[model samples]
Target: MALKELEVRYATKRSRDYKLADGEGLHLLVRPNGSKLWRMKYRFEGREKLLSFGAYPQLGLAEARLKRAAARLELAAGRDPGARPDRKPAMTFEKAARAWHEHRAASLDPGHAARTLARLERDAFPALGKTDIRAVTSADVLAMVRSVEARGALDVSRRLKQHVSQIYRFAIPHGWADTDPAAYLSDLLKPKPRVRHMARVGMEELPKLVQAIDAYDGEETPRRRAVTRAALLFTLFSWARTNETRLATWDEFEGLETAEPLWRVPAARMKMEREHLVPLSTQAAALLVSLREISKTGFVFPGDKPNQPISQNTMIYGCYRMGYRGRQTVHGFRGLASTWANEAESYRPDWIEMALAHAERDEVRGAYNSALYLTPRRRMLQDWGNLVEHMVTSDAGVRRDDVEEVGPPLTAVA
Candidate 1:
């Protein structure tokens, strides 16, 4: 009997490598690491022979059968199916994208590399992955951009275009193709009116978000529940971007035993090659101290998998479970903090921007320890953390009584 697609797919790896038969000398070779490659056996010129037909799913059952029939035909004609001198490997988009991603990822940071490939897998692969690199036309690229734009994500459309261009740029040097089809379509795309902002809840709506987070126990494991709570609360207190928080290491912290603790983000890990100094608030410092009792490695927030950082998606999906899927991102906490600080006007614009690790008005400034006012920034962060704690636990949602108790500090944050 022929092998069913389901059986071929559901086959699991064993301690030792093994194979599965499909009755006509066709077999699925299963490696211990779970890779399944298709192979066929036959006899030619009074000698028993075997031929590998490539990996399963990539070369399916029907295609394998066709190749087998063709091989038999060639053998009957006294020609060799096992060897083809004229054959050249197909230039598939998957092939080129893998090559490009590998080469491009080397020059980029770990976080950016992971995200770029993820987009390729999700958006680009299904449509163009198998297409020949040289055969892809501008029309094909247009359809892809239009498909994403139809979903109302103009930013995603732009990113897809940029990644495609990079892939083609890589292919040309490697002798895969001539010109980039995606490059020609740049003129056709309408410029986005403004950069889309990360979704964030206003002060009036914050208590509901906090209540949902506090009530969350997570669906699967105890670690999941604990990680969710710690990550969410840390984000609320520190107001850092998702990736920055998720990939945080224990070595990045300093002065945790003192009243003025800080998180020193290294340049290589940052978006730009500039060091960012984050003043740890009283609550923020406490969270780190609690995390210290259990962490076995340098990772402040360890991942579910051994020797891995906490996943960026896991942090974002915490709110997805809280029924704020489209209304809040992990970075939304930063947006909320930015809004509150600017509105309060207790601190100067430079102080708030510096605290956020954003560029200064001069665009080229001294390091955080020298130029930016650390003393004032520390006080600003503490004030913000205190307000956030009140918001998280308050029942009346920062009503008149809550507002009256906390006033901006009398001393100027100069």
Candidate 2:
């Protein structure tokens, strides 16, 4: 007779061992040591196999029955119960993300790579870190994206989608899973809000900004003041990105072998991934020479911590201190330079873009190009700087036309 619950309980009390038969090849074994185990006997691939259903009592009879039902359903669908690849051990999403990051670490910028990894560790890992990769569905990914979006980290959510997509691609080639759940993430992501800081500073505001930056006194900390001052000036003259300038290392700058004792930025620090030549004007080169004495150890703008560059926030705080807070942004320096060149009419747009290390986005045009617009860009930067310098030092030379004629020049008076 098939074992009943009461008979099994009696057997356990008398002989300290009991066996209960669950219909359709399932059985429960309860031992004297109070251990219960679920086992399924089945045929697959022309062989008989016993599959363990995990610990009993801990999993409970109901849970064990549910697992048995799932296995039976698989068999009914003509799937092999023993040869099931889906049941094989799989990695958690967090583990997959790490594995993917490791493969591409060398190709990414250090700052960006670190931040990406840290974000995943903080946001995505705790909830889904332990789940098997193959078992994770599109719904799971959508849920994670929504969580990030709800927290007002929409940009992060977008980037996380890209990161997860890369992970899925990595998983596909490895035979881990057949589908990329992250593929649909683009449609699921919330649209990014328009940021108002995209505006470029007008020519009229350029001089006042320069003058404010120049005359502004920083904190009592001499190192802080000097570094902040240097960063502002470098932004004006170099037209480099905020991070590129702030993170400058002493090693990236090499004294030129030519006339004005210029300092060159290396390929790695530059956005174009190519070495940049900065023909330092007298004032610019002097600033570099002065900085070399104080910043001789490591970074040109070393933080309070040894060997690290000043935080990006330092330059931002300096902007606030100089009274250019909401009127402009740290990234506006690029716009100011680009706008000034456009208004000058003598400078080439491509030359300005090259100076800022922006490669032409037009793929066909970019593929055939290899020049770095050194001379024209240098002249444009100098001309722009001269205009700012002139306005800051004296008010008499300030031209009202510089501001009025900027975007679309009103038809020049006949």
lDDT of each: 0.74, 0.67
Model 1: lDDT equals 0.74
Give model 2's TM-score versus the native structure: 0.54
Instruction: Evaluate candidate 2 by giving its C-alpha RMSD to the native, one decimal.
Output: 16.2
Give one digit per residue, the lDDT tens place, for model 2 in 10-76: 4352245455787777787665556566777777666455666765556666677788889989888
**lDDT, candidate 2, at 286:** 50
For 332-404, candidate 1 gives per-residue lDDT tens digits of: 8878888888999898877787777775535235423346678888888899877766655534222232112
**Best candidate, TM-score-wise?**
2
Please state the error at residue 337 of candidate 1 in Å: 0.3
Clash count for each candidate, listed in order shown: 0, 0
